[model samples]
Target: MGKSPDIIKDTSETLKPVSGRGITVMQGWYDKNIKACHVTLWDLGETDDNFSDDDAEGVTLSVQVTIFSQEDEVELAREIKSLMKADGFSFEGRNGDDSEPEDGIYMKAQRFSKFYESEE
Candidate 1:
């Protein structure tokens, strides 16, 4: 099985506390109604396929986490990074330049990767 579902569930749970009035954490796309801020997760892909003699496969999964804030707060972003790191994800790099997706909402995306071996 792919790690996309697990990654999404872990990410959503990890960032749930950060979701509040203006802030929202979701997988794939951000809510249109919540214009204040958004934390979105996207599955980049899986690689490093390995097959063992026992008929088990292993792979590394990559997921991109984009954080948008309307108030231009750095603390929240920092906290999120810390949380992700603690959750066994390594910071790959910044996806691209920070931009304004909406009027005042600033968006910045960071890539994270984790290795998971199939338990099948």
Candidate 2:
């Protein structure tokens, strides 16, 4: 029921408490120049929706997260995934490719989707 931007904002905020220590949380893409631990969120698409005058239900959406770090960030990723799961989001799946764009930047990513219900 929540809009894509709203969901993204919530996700970013949820991750904010864990941010710092050379890591940053952001909605959408982060600046490309600074090569540190960065977390970016994106709304991929809508899956389905069931709505009435009183409420909106079964509304699902896909979200993408890209992590850039100098070393392995599995723990950080897991923390994020756990946070999302605990926040009532469903884990759709994830990708296994990690990249080093330039020299010390290690990049990893995950994708998830969840259904939301809200009063309308």
Candidate 3:
């Protein structure tokens, strides 16, 4: 099985504290009606066990986290970076400059990566 579900669950749990007041932490996509912290995952590659080349060992994945808010998002973005890092993700950096996609909503995206060892 893929580690997608585990990653998503960990992300949701890590960001749950910031999930009220019309804002939410979601996987894959977000609702435009409210503020959101959206997470998208991509499997980058896999590694083989060092001892035996035939056995799969782990996978590396890239996680894109985008935050959309009706207010300034710098503080929230920093908080998210800290939280995700504490949860074992290595911060890769911001994906792009912050932008206002609509009249009042602001958006910022960041990248992170993690390696998950295969389950026996």
What candidate 3 gets wrong by more than 4 Å, as runs, is 1-5, 20-22, 35-54, 99-102
Off by over 4 Å in 1: 1-5, 20-22, 49-57, 96-103
Clashes of each: 0, 0, 0
- What tens-digit string does per-residue lDDT give for candidate 2 at 12-80? 766776774547777777566767678888888775568666555666777888787778788888988
**Residue pairs with backbone atoms closer than 3 Å in model 2 (clashes):** none
Cα deviation of 117 in candidate 2 (Å)? 1.8
Model 3: weakest 10-residue lDDT segment is 39-48
Model 2 residue 72 lDDT score = 75
Tell me which of candidates 1 and 3 scores higher on lDDT.
Answer: 1
Please identify which of the two predictions, 1 or 2, would achieve the higher TM-score against the true structure: 2
lDDT of 3: 0.65
Pairs clashing in candidate 3? none
Candidate 1 pairs with clashing backbones: none
Model 3, range 13-88, lDDT digits (tens) per residue? 7776666443567676446655444433333333334345676566656667777666658887898899889988
Taken over the whole model, the C-alpha lDDT of each candidate is 0.73, 0.73, 0.65
**Which residue runs does candidate 2 get wrong by more than 4 Å?**
1-5, 20-22, 50-56, 99-103, 118-120
